[model samples]
Target: MNAGRDAQAAATERALARAHGLANAFLASLAERAVSRAPSPDEMAAALDEPLPETGSDPAAVVDEWFERAERGITASPGPRFFGFVTGGVTPAALAGDWLASAIDQNAGLWASSPAAAQTELVVLRWLKELFGLPVEWAGALTSGATMANLVGLIAARQWAGRRLGFDAAAEGLAGHSPIVVVASTEIHLSAVKCLGTLGLGRKQVRKASAPGGSVDIAALATLLRDIDGPVIIVGNAAEVNSGHFDDIAALADLRDSHPGGAWLHVDGAFGLFASASPRLAHLTRGIERADSVASDAHKWLNVPYDSGFAFVRDGAILREAFAASGAYVVGSGGWDPFTHVPEMSRRFRGLAAWCALKAFGREGYRALVERCVDHAAAFARWVEATPDVELMNPAPLNIVCFRIVREGCGKAATDELNRLAVRAIQEDGRAFVTGTIWNGQAAIRAAFDNWQTTLDDVAMLQAAVKDVATSLTP
Candidate 1:
């Protein structure tokens, strides 16, 4: 038995060393690799799928095989010039922390389960509140992503509203009671709508308000709130997804205050909340502190690893009551149990990556990152405006440039089709990557600059690629 144990330990060490080497090689090659690769489902299945072996196999060999097979199929999202979905590149410090967190394998649910994980999360939450200019006393939790973060905040809002209506929402749901009114801008992200639906608030029943150019109309919101009497919750946007425009959250908060019934204000900042880190762009997030809850993605502008988000609530007790579970076996040290605030009971040590990022970058490092991305967006927009064949689709307020191809005597359908062709051509060319969106009812292309590795050279290359594609399609 001693001999077998020794062999197993040695085998594990060897496998880890091999994996480390493979990871380094893959990261080193990001600069020259294609931004994305098209791999068929059959190809992946053939390489990864097989019947489970009846006998044991060598661990090191298995790791090597998986890495080699998956390398070609991997997308270069971590590389520079990936301007799709407002994604961010992983920084060195954050990647190192992720490695350590995976090695430790801590379940960051309870204080007793992992003391370090729980305390680290608490510290990270405080740091995030400070960075985003949110109230420092608010309760926060690391979530899977913005979607889950939004859901958690909405859950708290729903519960708080139910309690106001004389029922414990956590204990008793709103099945046959008066329905709470949810108000949101038409331009709000789809994730917030999905959160409302998951929280038992009717998505179709939401009072759709006008938000011209991504800024919610305060007058329209006031009119809707005047009609809503009972429990109410208003969803606000810190930044719109397409044009990077910000809603007047401070004004929304004021509206909530003036309403007949005090309403819970939840803001979906997502990537836009990072603008608060920069002094120049901090003005964009004015009045965000007044929100009852705020949700943002750490993986977006924070340049951390994938699947990381944050949710902050002004009422800590309400947040805990909404999600905390009680059981005979469940015990807590009363020191920061994440399970009380987040939906998941078993979650990864996600706070490690965020902590590493904040510590390594500090305030100045983050400010520079946010400012640099905003500058890049402005520079790219200038290039777009200079190009006669392209028309700016929306105002490049922060870090997203929305544009579409234009030509003389080209109809709307033809122009949309040409832009679609341009998208296909540029993506196939593999120099840079972008996605399409509908801006003011016209098909437009969007270049979302959030990746830290994206430089001016990559942006120039992207501009040239788009021009070439447009020329080809128009000719």
Candidate 2:
């Protein structure tokens, strides 16, 4: 039996090696293109459908067949031209670490179960804290993404706030406690409200504050805080998703200091938190360190693969008390038990990918890469400003540039249709890809520069394509 198992393992490794090579080649091909061809429903069903095996077959053959069928259907979101969402291209070191993590298949619930994983996570967390200028003693946990990280941070805030009001909300539910009001900017991510709903706090329970340039309106926020009767949790944006605008953290922290009733401040810095790493952009995120809690995504500006998010809290004891599970099954005394900090019992070894990326790139290397992307975005914005048939929609604050294709002698509806048609043409053309969004109730095109593989030449090509499409549409 041991011999058979060893043979199967070796075969599986061989198959994986071959699959990796093919996948890398496919990714390389996408550098010169925009969007990948979408697979039809029939193609997807055929690739995913399988029968239960009555008898074991060769693992090598099975792996090969799986890749062959699935490769064409896979979305090239990892490619250079995928700029629709707030997604970042994964670094090679991180991808390789993910491969090793899958091979280890360790459940990083506690140190005893996977000491190496726990230690690595601790190291990564410390490194990240230092990188972002967070308090060294603060506690953090690896989460799936910003959504889960926000959920965890908000849970901690809720617990800490509940304690001040003489209630153990975690132990005894929020049955009789005053309703907790969550205050955030109008441009805040929808995930915050979703988190409230998941926590049994109604979505409508949040008080929306007006924002200027996507940052929280300090005046509006102060008014909301004064008007609210019960405990309040102030949610601030580090980088507004729509325009990459940052909130005035310094001013917000000052308000927190003067408020009579204690208010928990949570910074939702999913992709914006990393701006602190760049000396050029660090000033934009001033006072981020003063946040009571911060949630960021390692998969975004950190350039790590997916399933990497972090939640940092100033009070370690609060996080452990709020999230720690106690029962007959759980072991009491051990090195760091991740389940004590985050809401997960069986989590993958996510720390490996983050640690590997940091070790391979070093701090300066990532900072330089991010700076380059920002420069590219600024140059693209300048190009849009220069073009006759293009109109700049918003100031390119970070890496996202919003603009629209100008239609000659066309009405608002016609111009809107032209912009929509232009984006579709770029995707269908496959040389460049961009998506459209409504900005200030006007349709506009957005080109996000987050991929490390993207270059000035690619940007120029995309700009030229947009011009060609717009020129063709003119009557």
Candidate 3:
């Protein structure tokens, strides 16, 4: 048994060395690599789908096969010019930390399981709170992404409302209880909407009020607040997804204070919360500190690896109660046990990447990153404004510029069709990418920038690509 174990360890070492070399090779050519690749072939699929062999292959051979199969099929979403979905590319420090975390394989659910993971998470949470100007005392959990983070906040809101109605929500759900009223702008993120639906709250039932200029109308919100008698959940969107426009968060917090139903403000900051880290952009996130709960995605704007998000709840005990579980075997140290506050109890060590990012890029480094990306957006928007065949659909308030292709004498229908075809064409062209979105009822294209590695040259290349593809598609 000892001999076999030694052999397996030796094999793993060889595999790790080979994987390291292959990863370096792949990353070195990321800038020149195709931003998008076609779907995998049937032959490649069948080659990978064969039955399991009685004698397994060596680890080094397995690693080689894995890369050989995956290299061509992979999409360079981490490339500098991938302006889709507001996804940020992995930074060097964060990637290193992620690899180490994977190697350690720590279950970050309990301090007993991994004290380093738990403490690193706690320290990282504190640092984030300080960076974002959130209250330092709030309880936070590292989640998979903003979707789960939003769910964490909404779960707490649901439980708080249930308790106010004189029942145990975590113990017994709201089956017979009154449904809590949720209020938000018409532009509430799809992730937060999904959270509401998952928590038994009706999605269509959310009361929405949009101002004439596409923000939430404070007057309309006030009227809705006065009508509700029970607990209410108000979502203050730090940044709207389509155009990256920030809602009046400070104004929303003030309005939430006036809600007759005793509102719980849950801010889905996602990528936008990073604005608070910048001295120049901190004004965008004013009054986020007073929110009952807030959600953010490090992977979106912090330039960390994928699957890093945070949920901060003002009431720590309430957060724990909302998702509490107990077991005789799953013992926890007296320190902070992450499983108490999050939905999952068997989560991996996600905090290491975030901690490494914060440590490597201190306050100044982060400030520069946030400001640089915003500048890139502004510069790209200028390019869009200078061009004739594009219409700026929604203003670029932060890092997302929403525009659509415009043809002379063509109506909205024609422009929409042209933009739809342009999305596919640009993906096929492979120089750059901009995602599709509907802005104010018109099909539009969004150039959302977040990757740290993106430079002015990439942005310029993207501009040329857009003009070439979009103009060719039009008249």
Q: After the best TM-score superposition of candidate 1, give how far the Cα of residue 127 lies from its true spot, in angstroms.
A: 0.8
lDDT of 1 at 90: 94
Please tell me which predicted candidate would have the highest lDDT against the true structure: 1
Clashing pairs for predicted structure model 1, backbone only: none
Candidate 3 residues lying further than 4 Å off, grouped into runs, are 40-55, 211-214
Q: Candidate 1: misplaced stretches above 4 Å?
A: 40-56
Backbone clashes in model 3, listed as residue pairs:
none
Q: Where in model 2 is the C-alpha error above 4 Å?
A: 40-43, 46-57, 473-475
Candidate 3 lDDT, tens digit per residue, 429-475? 88887789887788888888899899999999889888888768853
Q: What TM-score fits each model? A: 0.96, 0.94, 0.96
Clashes of each: 0, 0, 0
Q: Rank order by lDDT, top first?
A: 1, 3, 2
What lDDT is reached at residue 459 by model 1? 89
1-475: candidate 2 lDDT, tens digit per residue: 6998998789877878777877777768777644645567897888788888789866667767777788766666777767666778888889889989998899988888899999999999999987878888898899999999999889998898889888877788788887777888888788887988888767888888888667788998898888866667888898877668888998888877777777888999998888888888999889988999999888887878887899999888988888757788777556988998898988999999999999998889878878888888899899889999899887878888888988568788888888888777766666666788877777888887777777888777777777888787652
